[model samples]
Target: MKLSRILKEVKINSIYRTGAKTIKKGGFRKNSNYDPDISSLHYRAQDVQPGGLFVAIPGLFADGHDFIDQARMRGALAIVSQKPVQSDHSVTENISQTKAKQIKNDLTVIEVDNSRKTLAMISAAFFQNPSEKLNIIGITGTNGKTTTAYLIESILSAAGLKTGVIGTINYRYLGKVFENPVTTPESLDLQKILDTMQKEGVTHVVLEVSSHAIDLFRVENCFIDTGVFTNLTQDHLDYHGDMDSYWFCKKRLFTEYLPSGRKKDRAVAVINRENAKGRELFEILPVRGISTGNSADNMIRPKKIEHGLNGIAGNVLTPSGSFDFKSPLVGKHNIENILSAIGAGIALDLSLDHIKAGIENLFYIPGRLERIAGNNGCFVYVDYAHTPDALSNVLGSLKAISQKKIICVFGCGGDRDK
Candidate 1:
């Protein structure tokens, strides 16, 4: 893509051409007008290809700005940075001064105030803003995001729509599954994946939105059609510092991001009314809000529910209609997940039958209270419940169903908030 087109939505401070002095003024060069054709975008110096644009991101571990010469040596045509580009350095001091000067003279550097945000905007523009073309459901909270996302994905798939999912387990679409390194990927990788999904005819996408992703501008320009707030609990306090900051980060999904989605008229917030934080979020949502929980006042709730070791069966009541839903997912906590998914389905204008089928079709979600058959009538379950609230819910559910004693084994990771 042309450099100008790639940076269409980016907040550019100034653009400097080859051999051009760093202008003090904050604007494009009027005299030196050259928009280089960028082959690709890269944050790491090692990934830069010939004619690629390198974005220097200031990170906690290492700064990308320090490796600008390496990116240039790898034939990066343009450079994007928050700091002023230094033209005097080579990839190493071993290189002669003449070679360094020649390399600097052939490069184009674009300065911006925030490189991370700029990367997101430029990536969206370069990828033609793929999130805008598809209905995207963003699930955020301390827990239940993965299960809720799986439920929503199943519903969308039942509607005969091609679906894509990005979450903690994996990113899968069109029979392809990629391991997920993080709950939410960086903006460039995310945009590229969404673009590929759009090209493959995916009509709906479900994303697990993390607080870190929101705070770091990873999902900056992605248009979210439906935003689901499962529930906020005391988790990730180590990264966020406090409950208020964490809540604020989650609130941005509804208040700031949802308004800019393609389905502006149809944008909806699915909130867990049972949760105190979720209840507060529902009242302040700018878009249409669908309250979901076990309460009668909730827009989506499960009635005549039965929970057992086999699974959960219930009649889900939604604004559109009521339907009988069955799932292999056990526990009372899953009831909230199902309600959130039901609300998301309703917000997306799906039929009750489709939602019912979707809920029933999913037999299991990996590591979310997965049941394993054991010898001598014993039952073993493996679950990814790291937080105190999550563990409490899982153990509470086991205690409720167990005829005998329940043995629990768990380990906590080092350097995280307990």
Candidate 2:
């Protein structure tokens, strides 16, 4: 696609303006009509392609205005700055904090109120909106987004669909894996991953949409076919400051911006009914929703729940009827994850039988109730349950089968949940 088309689609209304010193330095594009061969939807100097549009997003820690010089030096043909316009200001003065605030008026920067949201819009435009071409499922919550995302990916893959996944563990597509530190990568990386999946013929994608991602508007323009709320708990309080704010952040995936060109009713919401916040999220859904829980009212309800040494067994009651499934995914929390996956399968038009088959076929998911072997008859399971809700579930699940004392050795992070 052409540079103008990318900018036009993303509503970026500005042209390339080489800085005076940059023009004097000679590597910059002098002409306003000069278009770049490649463009980026983010501000990362490293990720900037030659002739890319660097999105200079100002954050609490540092102003993107500080990095504009570096980006310009690295062949950034244009920049989309998120600075406010001030009436009484001048661009001729040296670039200072005071001066940058003032120059927002006459600069040819594509100014946006929210840079994070703009990045999502630009990424979607650059990637030709790849999320629309695939069945994208977003799993969000304080906990279980990673587990549930991986679980859904496993179930989908077992059903013979070429699926890709993006979560806390990694970004994966057709056996190719890349480590991901952020639970959700920035919008441009996500778009590139989806674009790769699209090229690799991946039909479905299961992505873990974190609250940070939601608050940052990282997925503002992505089309999510189904949004699943696993379970919310006290987490990311350091970032959001309060439970209300955290919940509001997670709610973005289900409530605020969703992809365009799809039927309004097509964006189905799948929620965990056992969780109070998840149940509350269901009420906010404009479209009819499918809920999963261990209780009666849930569309995907678990019955005859039993835990064993190896795994857990349960009969899930779907819209069609009840069916039995046994998975290596232990703990009641994992049962909830199973239900979330079942809800996703049903949303995708798969029958109860196919869903059951898919569930049973998944025997492994790293770090979610993962069993470690030892010489004795003792059972040791490892999990990614740093949050209070997840900790209680893991310990409580083990306590059900524990004849002796159930000792829980744990430690909380210093900076988080403070």
Which candidate number maximizes TM-score? 1
Q: Can you write out model 2's per-residue Cα lDDT over 163-203, one digit (the tens) per residue?
A: 99999989888889999888888887888889999989999
* Candidate 1 residue lDDT tens string, 1-418: 8887888778777776545454333444334446778889999999999989999898868989888888888899888889876445432244567656556436677889999999999999989999989889999999999999999989998999999999999999978999989999999999999999999999899999999899989999898888999998888878888889989998999999898656667788999989999889988889999999888998888899999888899788888878887788999899999999988889888898998999999988999999888989988899999898999999999888778998999987755463
Candidate 2: segments with Cα more than 4 A from true spot: 11-42, 84-108, 258-263
How does residue 14 of candidate 2 score in lDDT?
Answer: 37
What lDDT does model 2 reach?
Answer: 0.74
> Residue 417 CA error for candidate 2 (Å)?
2.1
Clashing residue pairs in candidate 2 (N, C-alpha, C atoms within 3 angstroms): none
Query: Can you tell me which runs of candidate 1 are displaced by over 4 Å?
Result: 21-33, 89-105
